[model samples]
Target chain A: MISLTRASRWYGQVIGINDVTCTIQAGLTALLGPNGAGKSTFMKLVTGQLRPTTGDVRVFNQRPFANTHVFRRIGYCPEIEALYDDMTGRSFVTMLAAMAGIARAKRAERVDEVLGMVSMSHAADRRIGGYSKGMRQRIKIAQALVHDPEIIILDEPLNGLDPVGRKEMTALFLRLATENRCVLVSSHILYEVEQMTRQIILMDRGRLRAMGDVYQIRALIDAHPHRVSITTSRARDLARRLLEFPYILSATLDSADARQVTIETRSPDAFYDDLPRIVLADGYRVEELDSPDNNLEAVFRYLVKG
Target chain B: MVDLYLLRNALRDLASAKRLVVAAILIMGPAFIALAIRLGMGSQFDGVLTYGTLAALLVFGFVLPILAVVFGTGAVSQELEQRTMVYLLTRPVPRWRILLAKYVAAWIVISATGLLAALALAAVTYQPTPGSGRTALNRRSIVNPRKFLAQLQTPDSPVVDYVTQRLSAETLEQLSRWDPDTPAPRPLLRMVLTDLNKLIAADRRLYDPADFPEINVPDDARQLMAERPRGAANARLNRWLLEAAFPDLIRTNRTTGNKLYRDVLVLPVGAAAYGAFFLLLATILPRALITGLFLAFGWESWVPMMPGNFRLLSVMTYLRALAPHARPQTASTDMMQIFQALSPDTVPSALAWIVLAATTMAALALALAIFSYREYVPRDDAT
Candidate 1:
């Protein structure tokens, strides 16, 4: 329900987002990036908080920059931690709900309903200044949801949540997505988003790097030669034998470890499947096996570098 | 709904205990001074003169402007400083409506503080005027004879001419030796009053009421008794008749404290003008508070006394027009009063009202327009 056409923003000479085009539909979609990867800038554009310096941003086919119609349809949870410290969570939610044009008859009910949704009902009447980071996160999300907008953009919403809170929030996002609402969540961490959705738009250095299913992106990362390290008394023998497999691209012995052999292969599944057979046949003792490619950081490294 | 919430939040801030304490402190400043004056100079108290000068110099010129700058400008800057603006701006309400709502709150605060300060000054200094003892007279109410005494000390005052021909050379020397710059002791002023009173009463005998058939000698007697007529009487009989009117006129009275109400009433208008201008400045400029202080204290302090119609440019000028103060006999050399004390000008109250209203509306409209179009996204260091 949101689209960006060659959207780019700059702060003086520093680039925030550069020449990025993307469309977000009604479902769960994670914006994945490292810090300074323009994810927040992209979120601000979609949420109508800012206009792109040289591009078009549309929400529901209308430009979203300071447009009330788009604003009424979109909810935003910003990454900024500052909140109205003196106000109660309920008061904060009620104020925003009122501004969101919720009728007075339903404003209080909606504020309460959203506070419950974020599991903030118990402490809703307490001043937000006394709230912990997790409570503050929940309240921010509560305010965003209080308006009942069709599209919700959350920037680093999971940053301060504990494991259970994170899990609950992920489940909440999953439920919202199932209801056919557009939920665009941005984060620098991969595993946090991995729990919520398979679809992700990866960005790095102000440019869109990849966009698709999480596994597909992983597969794209895997297409490059993957490294698997093995430790054994006969490391040189295993290196010599591992080359017989057609999928194994190369094998090199670790210079510091006499018993370790590192193998490179484009087909990780095939190499893994054949390694046990090769070791069983050769009767070479294998003590340990490890793959650096299992990590998303390593995946980003391989993809972003390429 | 948006307007209600915005206004409520702004009012809530004003209702805080900290603000209450600040209000108490500001109002006490004028109260204590009035008390000290009333106690120090008991029977000789002149509330009109005191309230007139202090209200104009302190309340209208200083307190109102400072309060407007802090509260009015803080309506926007405080929100931006705390980064709470993002929440307000990102809502479904139009930007201008939000700013207008907040401005209303600031205006109320500024007007209320100014009103309370004036009320405090008026309450402590309230006294029945010494002459009529009923109606509170303004700067024009020459309740005190010192003003006339000061008038008589002038180089070619007609009353001085009238007195010179009658008094001994030694008494004339006392009148001459009494410097107008440094106010003469109270006894010396009374001595001048007694002489003038005696001479004018004696002069009235020169023309019997029956002799002047056209003059309404009984009813117009008090009216003529009120002021020193600046010699419109060149004819010998007219001069004698003019001198005849001085008996009741020279029976000088001190000003009552109740006269401060007009000065008090003019403060809200001043608040609106100052509040709107500074509110606009805060929205447009980054360092608006400092600029506002300079303008309020530095620019407004002197523009009203800039030798000509230049007072037309200052908000203080219109306020002064709406609530004019009686100039004190003693010359005040402070920067706030230096120019205003030296240069006295008359402004039509109607013109002051129209200009103030127009300036306030124009500033508010510009502030609303700027707030609507400008991007005030509080910078997030994270991104």
Candidate 2:
């Protein structure tokens, strides 16, 4: 577990992270943000690579900065792509496993096991310099997992992966979360983090914007108007029917296609409940129904302005 | 086990083929220069002078310090430059241990490369001179005391004031116009010998081994001590005194091969201090390589030349004390003589050893302390 109490980090006049606080427990919790959103700085604080400029960052109830005990319990995968180019991936993993205090007799087994988990066993013997970006990302993940840490913090871990690789890594993160380990992944890719977990801490401009389940966050932001698009032959009739409800803020009939109408309403649940009744009673032809505000992207867009 | 892995990783990085290539060039550079000197100046080549100049100016002064800066700053900067430091720093090991392990690896490399340069220079330039032969030492002393006595004839020697203080006015008068060429005035010669014996007994820095190469004492006194005849009667009594008087001139000349080995012994201690200083520099300043080079060449080059007690602050001064060598005179190096004249001070061998150890410990301790507490952002990540 990691906890940040009014944690703020600054690089000279530039802020890395502003006054932000959160607690992360055992599960795959994505840190959602855009570029320079202070995600990497936040992760660095938890991994003991940096000290918070003005707050208390505690990992497992101890300050993480230069604290070897805390370091042993946490594994960090940084965003930087550079590695010891001359070293083979296997040797790189072994070296880190040794640094992690893994016994020599079991280091090889542990290294191989992690390499297999990341699907890097085939290229494990090759020099890292020759590895593709996907391979490099996997190797980074492998090193983070080699020590069997209780908490794994990865910054932009899915940056360079292919579609298939992304899916596999996402699944791996999900499986890791299921093992009762705290997995905190930070990414600017909103869709990718959404695929990993609904549990997230959303940030923008170095400040925590929102934290909790996507639906839960969405439910809390009911004051924002929601858009619903419906394709029906009786677009005029449906618009008139939708306007009868007070929750409907506006209705725009699509001019290019006369059969479609888009309605804006603050209360989507009430709208959805009344929509089928209106359609069934009128005997109307409702060929398609869709709402853009139904998923994490809409929730994220609604939560953080960025 | 973690320490071992850290050392191995650092050593592997240091011994990379790319670095080895540069180190090879550094190691062979002196030998190549010596070859050119041997070929161009053949027969006229004073092996002692050639070896001394190259060893001091080229290898010790330039090569050694430059390597220390490159290797020292490179020890940690290399990891950060490659963005590999994050991996090491995140491990369950103390930051100081990681840095110290890398420093030890860099120190081993700089010391070895410097020693090789010195050895290669000595090997290429070494020629059997008069006192170089084992049995030849008994017959031909490196110093021709007759020539020395002729040079010492001037009355206003460094000893003029020394004798005015220690001897009777009568003895000073007899010693003033002395000459070894003319038929001997036995009593005056005996007086000169006795007075010289007093200087030897005093254990003064006037003829310090470190100063022997530079030979900066006032003309008269330096002339007397530069080389003395091993008169059968005086040899037994004065041998130890003469050696202690100017060991660099006597020992380095008699055993040319060991000069480099002796330099080898001193090189690491010097590198350790220089390396530790650079390690500390890298920790405090981001542009440490540039700053270190400025300090290595700009500060270190001239600080030992600074007037008065200021020379005591330089690491180079102590290094010269630990392993004195003949600093060959050249137009560019005339600044060294000027500084030597201005600061006629020398650190004793025992003191040099102690001070170097203390400074090295101090620098490493400070570097370790700063590294332990501070945070380093990977350069790419910082942007």
Candidate 3:
């Protein structure tokens, strides 16, 4: 587990993460928040790149700054694309392995293994200078895993990857956690991160905003009345039907369009999962069905505001 | 093992820098011969080292040091500037090993080049006969002796004719009436050719303006002639006079001791300068700008800030003072006065050695520190 206790970081007059405290457990955990949410700052603190201005940051029960041994077990992929551009992917990974003092004969084998794991084996001979953004991202992962590190921390791993690349990378991440390694992936895309891992640690404005399972957090947001607007042939009938349900907190019909209606409900799960079944049984003709809760970005915006 | 790893990483890429290696060889090889030949001229006239040893010392001492500077600085600074050094730094190995390996490799290459140049120079300039006589001074012949004599006769030629009549046959013979001295003369006179041979020759001699006329030259022109040697003189004339004075002028060939002394004096200074430069480049070069700048110009201003510590001005000041007094050691009691007047404290040999050792160690240490600082660290921003 990685923990930061009452940790605060200040660069002169500017404050980064302030009075933030949390512990991250094993398994695939996503660090979720909007931009400037202390997500990257907290990662850097845990990785020993920066020291906390107050309190403590500990990984595997020790300070990480200048602690080479800790890094041996921790595979960290930074946000910046800072790989040596001249070296070929295989050579670059092999060089890091050699630095770790691995036997010369074992280095090539390790490079191949990591390349395969990241599905970069075919491009291993190519210089990193020629790599696309997504290819560079995979190569970074390959280097991080060259030593077969236990705890992997990847910050903004999907920043420059296309949708297909993102899906493939997300799947690879899922496979990584299955090996019993604790993987913490940080991102501002709530739904994208939600797809990667349900276990999460959430922060906002340099403070811990929420933590625990993805569904539990979603349930908390769902418990707060969710707003939905619908347009259909019988909007008054739909509003009347939604008002009768215990989950619906409020409902209203548009004055100009008899087919349009707006409704607020405490449980999106009840309205979404069962509303269609209820409408079908009544033989109601619904032209449109949409919910603002389809993405968690809306939910985070509402929670933070409240 | 880790040191070896770092060293390998740092050195592996540069091993293929053929241009740098070739440049080092070219510089050191020819420089040996030039140095030896220059110094050989000095001692050859005054019993200095044979042309052979001068040749050898020039190559071994001077050429070697310069080669070391080029090679040593090239090892670290060139790689860093090229940005290719990042490959080695990303490795897990420590920095010190990388620096030491590079320094040792460059030093070996330069020293080897120096040795090669020295050996080549020694073989080429080596003379089998060490006791060869002094080189002859050449002279030109006056082809029209009678015409020259008529030309020399004064406008009062009748008076000269009367004096010539009064003179006896033996006196006339001694006076050389055929080649008389004249103040004004006619143009188309036939003259007999005659040669006046050279009187003396001495190599390795730093001729003084005061002693030039001792060789049968005009007394008044001694100082004027001292400044320019063989101005507008042709090679044939030089050879004829050298042949004429071959026997009498042979005694003054320079001894071996003078040549050795000169070589020895320049050897250490040249080596020390080169070593200092390389050591500086090897160490924290970026930081070296700070200390080197101070050493170059800042020390003087900084020293007076502390009233008692004025050794800041010692290096250049000592060199300038010693330059004018470059004579061989003469035990004048005034020497003590000269030393006392300059400074109460005398510079000790042991102190100089300590300072050199400290400077070298600091340079190497700084190199190791900078090199190591770059190694085994992730520069990536992702984590």
Candidate 4:
């Protein structure tokens, strides 16, 4: 487990992370936050690239700052696009594996394995300078996994990846978690994080706003109003019926379309359960229904505001 | 083991960099100049030695240091500028080892290039048959021509008559073409006189001192005559003349000695010291290139010109201290004067080398300390 106790890092009065205290245990955990939300700073702290300004951070009961013992067990995929572009993908991964203290005899096998794992074996012999954005991301991931560290911390690993690449990476993270390795991935895209893992640690303005499984955190913010949009031919009639339900806090018609209605509800679970009954009784031709607050973005907004 | 790995990787990266090509061209400048000089000018051993010395001075004193600074200062900063430092920083190896590996790699490049250039310059200018078979201009025979004439003024001076008879009319006419008061005799007259002097000395032992009593011997000659019986005085005088008049032979000896001193000692030590110092500056300063330029051009250049012990701060001063003191035959008097003025006072070669080694170690240690403690954040990540 990696733990941060009252960890605060300040760069000349601009706080990167302010008094953040949390523990990341074994499993795939998504670090969800907007840009400049202290996610990168937290990753740097955990990877031993930085030290907390006021508090303590420990990876597996020992300090990670310049701690080779901890570093050997941890793999970090940085968010920055920095790489030795002149080197072939295989050479780059092998070089890092060697630096990570892997035995010379095992470096080639390990590099090939990680490259295959990232589905980059086809382009492994090509120079990274000519690789596309998705290829670069995959090569970066391959280097991070070349050492087979116990903890893999990737910041924005899905950035620039295509749909298929994202699916493959998501599966890779799941496999890592299944093997009991701690996979803490930071991403600002809510849907991407949601697709990767249900466990998330959300942050805003350099503070940890919430941490838990997505569903559990969503349950905690049930008191807040949830926004759900409905598309139907009889939107005005649905809005009137939604007001009749006591759980519906407010309802509004779409300005451009009379067939669309947006409604707010105090109890999302109750509303979701009763929505089919109401539609069936009124015989409204509902084409689509989506609860904006059901995903991690709404959970983050509600928890940050609360 | 980790350091070695890092070093190997760094060397590989350096080999692929385009800057290495530029650096190689810069160091080869002296070698090209030496080859040109060899082709244009005749390979007179003294002339070649003078040219070689000047080449060594240009390379070791200025070009080598600038190259070392350019390469060494970029050793770590290049990684930071490209934002690839994070890869090495995030590795399990210690930060000091990373810095050290890069430093060693840079040193290897700079020293190898500089020494190779020096070797090429030396090889091009070196003469295999130095001071051999050049009897026409025996420098010893020309020394103190008036004294030689006075010695031959005796009535039964067969040696003088023989020399005058041996002189060709053309040579005599050439000798008379110059002003009588000129210090230097005509070339043919000088050669004939040199041969005459050698013959007289060889035959002098057959004659008694009383037979040449009118020949006024100088105090040193008289002491030599008293110290040794018979013709030993003439032999001593002959030895002194050969030693004094042969400027080419003296220059040849000095140049050979200087070449060994410079190639074997000064260049390697200077390259290492400059490389290490630049590595330290690169680690500690944000603008290492500008600072290094200032130190190399502005400070090192001026400090040597300052009066009285002020030059002790300059690396060039220590280098000059370690260099052989023989001035090149082609060097201008002004250049010689400057070199003499800048050279430190009687510093032993061993002491100078020790100072250089100590400074290199200190700079490397300081670089390691700075690299170990300093935090490097990628530019895009800095908030």
Best by TM-score: 2
Lowest lDDT block of 10, candidate 4 chain A: A215-224
Q: Judged by DockQ, which candidate is best?
A: 2
Chain A only: list TM-scores of all candidates.
Answer: 0.81, 0.89, 0.83, 0.84
Q: How far off is model 3, as Cα RMSD? A: 13.9
Question: For model 4, how does the per-residue alpha-carbon lDDT over A222-305 read when each residue is reduced to its tens digit?
Answer: 677778999998898889988989988899999997788999876777888999998888798889887777778789878877
Off by over 4 Å in 1: A218-223, A226-294, B14-20, B131-156, B159-260, B331-343, B379-382
- lDDT head-to-head 2 vs 3, winner: 2
**Candidate 3 at residue A144, lDDT?**
70
Q: Can you give the DockQ of every candidate in the order shown?
A: 0.47, 0.54, 0.12, 0.45
Candidate 4 positional error at A271, Å: 5.4
- Fnat values, one per model, are 0.61, 0.68, 0.17, 0.56
Steric clash pairs (candidate 2): none
State how far residue A217 of model 2 sits from its true place (Å). 1.5
**Residue A52's lDDT in candidate 2:** 79
TM-score for candidate 4 = 0.78
Over the stretch B1-383, how does candidate 2's per-residue lDDT look in tens digits? 88899999998887878778878998899899999989999766778667767877778788889888888888887777777899999999999999999889889889888988888888898787765523212323434444333433542344333334555456667656665557546565456556554543443432343433433332212222333423432332233334333322232233456556668888999999998999899888877889999999998888887998888888988887766665443435466667777765566677889999999999999999999988888523741
The order by descending lDDT is 2, 1, 4, 3
Candidate 2: Cα lDDT at B223: 23
**Candidate 4 lDDT over residue span B138-218, tens digit each:** 444344554443333321454334444544565556554555455555464565455545544572532333344322222
